[model samples]
Target chain A: MTLHRIRGGPRLSVDNDRCERFGTCEWEAPGLFELGRDGRLRYRRRVSDEDAERAAAAARCCPMQAIVVRGVPG
Target chain B: MSDGDRIVIAGAGVAGLRAAERLRELGFDGELVLIGDEPRRPYHRPSVSKQLITGAARPVDMTLKSYTELDARWRLGTRATHLDTTQHVVHLPGGEELWYDGLVVATGVVPRHLPGSPRHDPRVRVLRTAEDAAAVRRALAASNKAAVVIGGGLIGCEFAASMRQMGRDVTLVGHARAPLYRFGPRIAASVTELHRQHRAGLAMNTAVRHWISTKETFGLHLTNNQLVVASCVVLAIGSVPAVDWLRGSGLTLDDGVLCEPTLFATGAEDVVVAGDVARWPNLRFDDEPRRVEHWLNAVESGRAAAENLLAGRGQARPFTPLPRAWSSLYEVRLQTIGLPALAEDTVRLADGVTGFVRAGELVGACGWDRPKAMLYWTAELDRRLPAPATTPAPARWSGPEARPAVGTAP
Candidate 1:
């Protein structure tokens, strides 16, 4: 459950156990998260500051609440 | 509005919580109050029928992480008894009345119960709250007899699937010819196959005619003259909008609180509606007002309602969301976008995708275990929808003059 943090921006992590693959995160932050054709979740571990808001929105939109964004700037 | 102004939100579910968050995100510094009938803070309700029943997640895991961050007065375990639109007052039980400059109705829905069902019977249960899920779990653990779930809707199906995963003999009973009939024949067939592969019994197109309870087990006599004996029975029939308290409130109530395209309560400028309790016509589709009881609708409508309330009616934009919902059963993941029930014809597309057509146009699409197909179809459906209306930018406020004078008529 360690919060991953990138040097310049926030980092994203999905709890594989809790993630139900709803694909809602992909809709909110397409570049950061995606639902592959194989029914698996594909996401970047770190995102630039410009994508922080969208990443946070994706985390909030997740029904499972499995997505976590760390080191978000105020 | 200044700090003296207040916005009282009724119902503290996901929609209500989202509305409060949006208000704060828009820099609302006015007094904010949330009234919830449930004693606890908002939690993810979908888990009640799935993970909670299977011992995979607890009640604590279902709570929303953002609720604790909102700085608002929480009035939990209290129901809103009455509404005085003219006075802009919301009356609660025990003669408590609170004044509000704006209101958001997100009371959500309550599960329907079967007639002649014993309320005190521990064997019969309904899955709406965390308490209900815990009770169902205890009942299942206590009995070795088969569990009978009386419904074929998503909730019932999920419950039945969870029970099967728990290695319990389960039977799903419904009046429809097949399970998930609202999703169309292909999905229904797929769901039926899934149930069959899981070795769960299906008693579709039948209903309980008699409820016979004994010291050891309960027997459900169906209309088709079959007896289902079980240690526990769950009623997942359906739910209706929790609008009983709004009967004399002067708000238009059909199946839910009727609202304008902007999510404002009809004839009430200062009030808005959201979540499963909101019945508004989606301008992207047609003029018929309908209630979308999906999870995404709660989030989208909640934010829209809050924004419209802050921007005022003159500058508010229409809440035209493409309805979306998803359900998980066994290894199958079903995702849908738009109103599948409104389609006149359904065509099966490649890679486990289904297209819903109304008036020779693609109005909805559903993916069965095909997330990629769903993504593409969702984009295609979005392209078909009318372009979003161009509304003036929301009126941003700063300092004390962010809103009108408190108690002033709009």
Candidate 2:
């Protein structure tokens, strides 16, 4: 339920406990999320408005349903 | 097309739900309807075997958030009985026919049952739906005897891991020499070793010879002359696509609904297929049409099918996706890209990395506890296989045009 806000864009968060590190989000939104070489998940706290659709697609495509992106206009 | 056109999506699983969402996201503001046999809304199915079994995640937690914003009619608990492609109608069990300008087939798959299994027996269970997981949990909690899980695929292995975490004595039985045999024998051995370290019994390369159920205990006699006794038996044997209703619908049906490269049903422009029920030539690896039953494939194909449906044949792009899947066994995480099952040889690249080769070419790669390696290999595969050529324009279909010619035979 922790929400991380971007400076002037949408907020985003990922529930680490539920995330299996599938790297699917990384595939959908490469600029926002990355699975590091050490087998860890690294993601930005927020994304710009232009990338909001990609972030939403990543959240929707996450197999674990762990990612949450808020303030993205439909 | 006008906003008054109707689009009916059969099957409300992840694929069907994704298609519906993509249709809306792509600005297809029209009449939308989703029909599914499951009584509940689409939920995350992968959790049923792991988190749901362990009570770590509830049914509500698995609900897809995208479903809330869908402005569509949902016909849950309703089975699609027949399809008349000529008249563009989907027949329901109660003689209700739904006509649509476009149709999406995403009925998904059903778990295959073990032959001669006692249907009325409470000890026997199969984990596919939420109810199945709950039943299995209840059965495990009610018994002190060891639990026998038949089949060593991803679902069975995951269930075994969850049961072990719950402090249950579990035995995993598989006909292959090791668990996850499709991922190559090395990764399978590592998984087998992980199970061994957890003190779970491994029954590999064996088939059940006899089913012995008495008043108190359930037992499985192996072909190797060993008896595995347990209070509960879970059959995790694979699944078959739920395409029974599409048999006489004039759509080519092999193991699944055969589709062209664009995911449109062969010889049909207005109908498209997606999810576990779609068999198409990936074109990323080969032209052989195959069905991929994975979580990512469902999400990817569902969106692709939806986009192609709107693009029509003239503007549609070929649907070519590299198949990917993953499984968790205890502390080990196995991830794979491309078709490992089609590999003729396997080469161990690193301590936890294995590369699959077919005809001296890398067809797939897998990583055990090495997510970074999987990502690297995924990029390599993407570079090796270029994106398929743009779909050629077939006959157009809209107002008065005849149905488009089927692109290519699957």
Candidate 3:
């Protein structure tokens, strides 16, 4: 698993092979996920403690369930 | 298990894919064969209209799951030509025959094109498939003229909204006064207002008589003898079950392949149907069988059908599916549940949202960007009703104030 680590926050892992870029994560956490010009999903590897809820929502709501957030800060 | 215990699934759409996954999850280790006429793997249909059309999602991004993730024999681009229910054989073109102990028909629906419609016209497109969506995207990018969309259903309104957002002058034509006639007046009026707010020209209560395609442009003539020229045209009228391949198969076909509550085909013992092609009585809704073409219905029915197929007919329980669907308008996401078709009365909620009532009960509800209300009502409506008992005249609904406050404020 390729972990995209965020500075001073939780680490994120997106199964690129499994992600279909449906952008549900973008709706859940706009700060974390943004669609690229080529219609692919761009996201932060990690997020601050304040954005943990949104990050969790994104991971939960993904139809493909491809987003994985780990090690959230207190 | 014996060689005859192999399971075959037709149509590699959402329903078929879900069934395959479910069978695997249930530890069905038999040989599984999935057949599809489309060259590509199963892709998400909902995003094809919203994200794909708006350039937020690519064709690759629409996949419900990767092809490698599905553990089955995939026969993509191969159409099932015939079925020999007596011999438990499926006939494919080029004389290929597949015999299965259990068969799942998830053949979904195909867009219903108008009579005398020209498929070869470069400027004409239908918004059913990913390829069709991509074609429209390309056409939209290359053209500078107005775009005319026929049939103001969900797809029509969605495309109109997206096209207008893309800065294309859009004119939406529908036979009804509103886009979604089943939602009743209040919700339809809100949708109408949304379209109007986006500056889409409404050609309601009209039909497209004919299409005139020239070398440079396309022209549409309406029922009122009004001619509108456009750079391209999209047809979003409706869809029909893709059941022609089962003609000589001896399977029961009314509007769709008739099935029992367990998703088992009425005429065949080992055959089951799911997705848009299956018309079975939903126990939750009166006993009358209905066909649902929504994405969530496909997933739920597919999983349920797989479970029943594994359990066998005598032990199988009836599949009761909850009706739910969502749509993205110009700026709001409309989530709805229950039988909007059963709606005889309407109640307008706050912020232009609406709910439909039948026999003095809230049979359906829809909201604009109202997730909490949509989710609560969706779950609430999934519970069994009181068997349609006759009651006195239903009081005029004054909106959300009448109902007791519980889960979320609408």
For each candidate, give its TM-score against the true structure: 0.94, 0.92, 0.80
**What's the residue-level lDDT of B78 in candidate 1?**
95
TM-score of 1: 0.94
Deviation in Å, model 1, residue B123 alpha carbon: 1.9
Q: Tens-digit lDDT track for model 3 on B323-354?
A: 66777777676777777787778887555458
List candidate 2 stretches off by more than 4 Å.
A1-7, B1-4, B391-410
Tell me, per candidate, how large a share of the native contacts it keeps. Answer: 0.40, 0.45, 0.00
- Lowest lDDT block of 10, candidate 2 chain B: B401-410
**Cα error, candidate 1, residue B287 (Å):** 1.4
Q: Which stretches of candidate 3 lie over 4 Å from their true place?
A: A1-74, B1-3, B66-69, B349-352, B384-410
Ten residues in sequence with the least summed lDDT for candidate 3 chain B: B391-400
Give the 10-residue window scoring lowest on summed lDDT in candidate 1 chain B.
B401-410
- Compared with the true structure, all predictions reach lDDT values of 0.87, 0.84, 0.76
DockQ of 3: 0.07
Candidate 1, A1-74: lDDT as tens digits: 22323365688899998888878899888989989877789999978878987888888788778998877754
> Candidate 1's fnat?
0.40
User: DockQ: which candidate is best?
Assistant: 2
